[model samples]
Target chain A: MLGAFFTGSAIVERQRLGLAARATLLLLCSGLSLVDSLHQANGSLDVLGRLSVLVAIAILAVVAGAAWPQSVWVPVAEAASVAVLVMANAGPHQPLLPYLLAPALEAGLIAGVRGAVATAGAAAAMFLAASPFEIRKGQSLTYSSTASEWVLLALATGLLAAWARRLGVRTAGSNEAYPAAYRLMTQLRTVSRHLSGGLDALSLAHIVLQQLRDRTGFDRAAVFVPGPEGELVVLAGEGNVPDWDTSLASDGLMAEVWSQQRGAARQSGFSGTKGLVSMALPLTIGARTVGVVALERRFKWEMEDDIDSLTSILDEAALRIETALLFSEIRTIATAEERRRLAREIHDGIAQELAFLGYVLDDLAARSEQEDMQGELRDLRAQVTRVVGDLRLSIFELRSEVQGQTGLGAALSDYVRSIGAASAMTVHLVLDETPNRLPVEAEAELLRIAQESVTNARKHSGAQNLWVTCRINPPAARLTIEDDGTGLGTGRDDSYGIQIMRERADRLGATLSISTRPEGGTKVDVALQARPVEIASDQGAGRDQ
Target chain B: MTTVILVDDHELIRQGLRRAFERDADFEVVGEAGTATEALRLIGELQPGVAIVDIRLPDANGLDLVKRLRAGSEKMGIVVLTMYSGDEHLFGALEAGASAFVSKDAPAEDIVAAARHAAVSPRAFTASDLAEAMKRRLEPTGPRLSPREREVLAMLAQGLGVAAIAKQLFISESTTKTHISKIYEKLGATNRAQALMSALRLGLIRQDPSPDRP
Candidate 1:
């Protein structure tokens, strides 16, 4: 009985059961067994026999009560030992059969109906053998009655075993389901937290994919979401699936799953190996298939059974993706509108005031006879132009959206020209690249990196000449920004800009290096590999607007 | 004197502009209007030689007013003065029949010169600023050529044929032709000279330093 409790405690820990109830059951079983074992001793022992019996019981009690049992076999072994001890020590006339019931009942509860019935059968056989020993010791046996009693005992044990088995199955099923549910709940919580925290769509998608990969424990997982072209493009993936084509055409199993807007098992030929079964789960929100998650290593039957679990997680992820996209849209619109308002205000207010100042200076210049006064007025007018240029650039940047249709190269070129016009430095821009736009997220990051580097140079470096070069070579590209400034490390106390650039480069899977030129100045070099191929016939046809 | 109607919302700007014009013997401030309706009425009543309109009037866009004024009379000069410096604004103004487009930050002399030029030859008047922006907006590349394409066009303008450009750019001749074709496509040109001319006019390619560039 005590061993049953020990085994139960182990199972409870593994299954995340309540600790307090299991501990109480263990204590109650141990106390009842000790009292019962002593009562059945029937004064058959002299002091030495009594001492031996007490010692034996004490040892059994300690093993059953204190020993930690991890497996079902541990408790089974203990039950067998208890039955043997009971048969060997209990006197023939005493109520000896009751002692045998403990082990049998425990086996029933811990292991199932078959285990219980088998244990009872063995106990009954041992008891019958003891009856023969009793007959040899001149104790007459009522054979007919004893045979009926044995039948009754076996019948009772079988019924108890069946009852225990039903209860055990239920507990086991719940034990399996609880943790999966909890993990999914936690994942949902994280998604909401990230959304409220205003993480951008790319970062949010990346984090969610990582979490899904970890939680599902798949050998390989990749998230393929529809790009602006309604073509499935690999957004993020784990394991040995990186080198595969990033875009998916509308005729494969992946596209079929997307069109079907449901999950099913399909076979894929990955990396030349044929017939590898994979589960393609579409992430749909309100009848629209937003994306598909392809998972290798999940068997067909297993996925069919676990589809509910997978869908619950994928559903939440889809909602999050939708929310993130909406959040970014709202942010973009709000920012653009706000900037336009500010620009209009500045144009009406400060710009007009400065223009009036310029005219005033012009009037003073025409009237003044002093050459020095006219020169000062001219210098002041130049200052006003610089201020106006600065304002215009600000307005342009605030209105600039990386996801805008004009493409990143144009935006960067405009920016560089504005800088040249505003500052004393001679800025040269060389952008030779394909017209195909980078993914919106990548464009945004590249723009940020360029802006940071240019601002850093303009503010601190005192550079006379700045050269910004962007070259696109189909699936790869390079951006090199060099300045004839006081070399790389001269006066850059702010490491934040460099850190941000590194982070952006890392996110884009691009290599970035900043170093001092051997001849003069500083150079920033960034090399980007891989541009997602367009699979859809028409670009940007997916957006309803 | 070229009689000019100054239609700006800011009183200080109108006063300063009036003074700048009063100083110039070739120009006169015939009227001033703060709103589009007022400007239309003043133009109709005073019949100024030129009307300078600010784009962001409280009541109406200067482009719409320009169109309305142009529909009324082809002879009256319409000059747009605004803070917007993008090619889009310049194009919008030009499409609405404004003869000149100038940034608000331009020197007083530039505005006076634009007014004088517009008053005399309203049909032929295209301020250098407006003409440059218009050319950029009309480029086949649509004012957004990548720097490398610009470099390629500049080299082509200097009379480097495809093979010479390829060698200079460290690329193959086939690649050079591809770049040249793309440049031509962007410039809306059927041949090399047309692409070069458009690129030069758009300020996309550097003008050849030769005396014959114009």
Candidate 2:
């Protein structure tokens, strides 16, 4: 359509040039004699006069199209526009013309709302200036109707242009914002990694603070607010603290800033903060205010934008920190639990033996007065001796495998020799195969299970002999402890032995079984296999029969 | 009279040991030394048939003196007398060439017999002797862990769990665990029961009350 219009423009301009090339044609074109005669004959250049001019131009352009189709459309638009201009000049209002609305509509299509409004305003000014001739001549023109029609045309054009421009702006703006959103999402993922990797609360807070500080170039940001019992301390900051406190305008309002979990702009327009605009963003982990980031700017800049960026960065970081803190707290709890367990073992095994030895020593001291009871005294000495041997084993267990750093077989062997020397019940440790230290969880659970089994024998089993056998092959470890003692209680009640054996086996992701030997004894067996290397051991172990 | 030599690093211990051997009518102290080198020189010159040694000597560790004495001549019956935890020194002394391992913590009569036994037997360690030998063999390693550390580790070994251990020991859970951890290190234990078992072997603790089951 534009091409067609351009072709017409070219053709009409050429014709005008051709006419100007001839003096007679140019004079006829520019001559004022016909226009003056028409004005004199009719004081108004009204409807008939404008229509006649258009018809004449139409005929002339058609007749000259022998020139070119490529240059015709612009002349057609220009001729229609010029005739309308002439008619408007001649008349105040052509109340009966539907086609008169087309020019304003075309103006709306051509240059949008601003241009159309300008054109309508210029046309209106021209009409009012020219209206004096009609008024003086007492033409009794429909001034209201004509004004209303022009106003309506201007309004319509303005509305159309406004709507189209808005749509275009929004579409372009959206395209630009999406990539940034994508970049922020990637940053979010990286932030998650950093937070989880921190492994504890302090590290998590530091990470969050760094990200917020770097992402938004706030002059100063600090997490001033403390959370629940003052346990939660904020660490991330963007700018210098002096600037923040003063706020470039000295309200001296950290409390005010913190209260408003949203961002605050305190420019240094006050006595305290004249150069700073401090922004406080609440670091919210869930609904709780774990921390608050206060950002202050000493310089006049785009402070709000930076605060917005800071808020987004803190959103994910808060969750991450909260999670990391929780994990660390849990680990602490677990360690405490583990220590208590070890203490119990020591109490059960060696402390009791030493106490017994004390009793034996007391008996021996008292018996020195009599030689008649020498045989009985000798038996007590043997018992004391056995107890001493058991105590040695207990000490070895007390030392344990120092973080599972030593090999299992060596540790077990050390265990047997030490404990066996002390106890009446001899511990014979035989290993069929040896493997590298089982990875942390596997080895730990394995060790725990063995400990439980041995303790059970020492206490309830009353076993005269204990054989701890381990086979490490096929990427698995099988532990079996056979005690020549009473069978698994003949009949059952709640005994801690089975529970412990099951718990240990489950912790290592292993299978476990307990059976009474046909030879009138009991055996506890455990088998551990490999599991996923990444995730840590299952926290809540299940007992599988 | 049977001549005797005494070697103990501690002054009081040496004095006590000297007093102990002197009490015996048949035994007479010919010489005394606080260290292995001095003890060796005295033995070389004096040639006392019975030599009393503290498991721990100033110049050397373990039972090298007993080994040194026996290797030099089979006539010397060397006895290791020391205050050792459980089997740490008991086994170590035997391995290093001591004829016997006797606790200084026990009645001095035991040490005397260890000396006399070394003098008469002059043979390999038997089952009854093996337990004492093993104790002395391991004695030099270290004393039985402290009673508290042992008690904690023993309860842990019973599979009482940390909460139960704490309750049983009347300690805070973490303290109980700390004791357990120390026991684990001393006993070379990985878990509670191992700690307990090791503790039992070390004489750091005693057995638990038996279940009321018949």
**Best by TM-score, which number?**
1
Error (Å) of candidate 2 at residue A457 is 1.8
Q: Which stretches of candidate 1 lie over 4 Å from their true place?
A: A1-197, A211-222, A228-234, A237-249, A264-280, A294-313, A413-442, A455-466, A469-480, A485-519, A522-545, B129-214
lDDT of 2 by residue, A44-65 (tens): 3444465455445444544544
The candidate that achieves the highest DockQ relative to the unseen native structure: 1
Q: What is candidate 2's CA lDDT for residue A63?
A: 50
Consecutive 10-residue window with the lowest summed lDDT within model 2 chain A:
A536-545
Over A204-315, each residue of candidate 1 has an lDDT whose tens digit, in order, gives 5556656655444455566676654444545555554432322354245566678888776655532213444566778888677878787665233333556556766788
* lDDT against the true structure, each candidate: 0.65, 0.54
Can you write out model 2's per-residue Cα lDDT over B57-94, one digit (the tens) per residue?
Answer: 65786377677777888767777764434454555765
User: Which pairs of residues collide in model 1?
Assistant: A431-B147, A431-B148, A432-B148, B140-B186
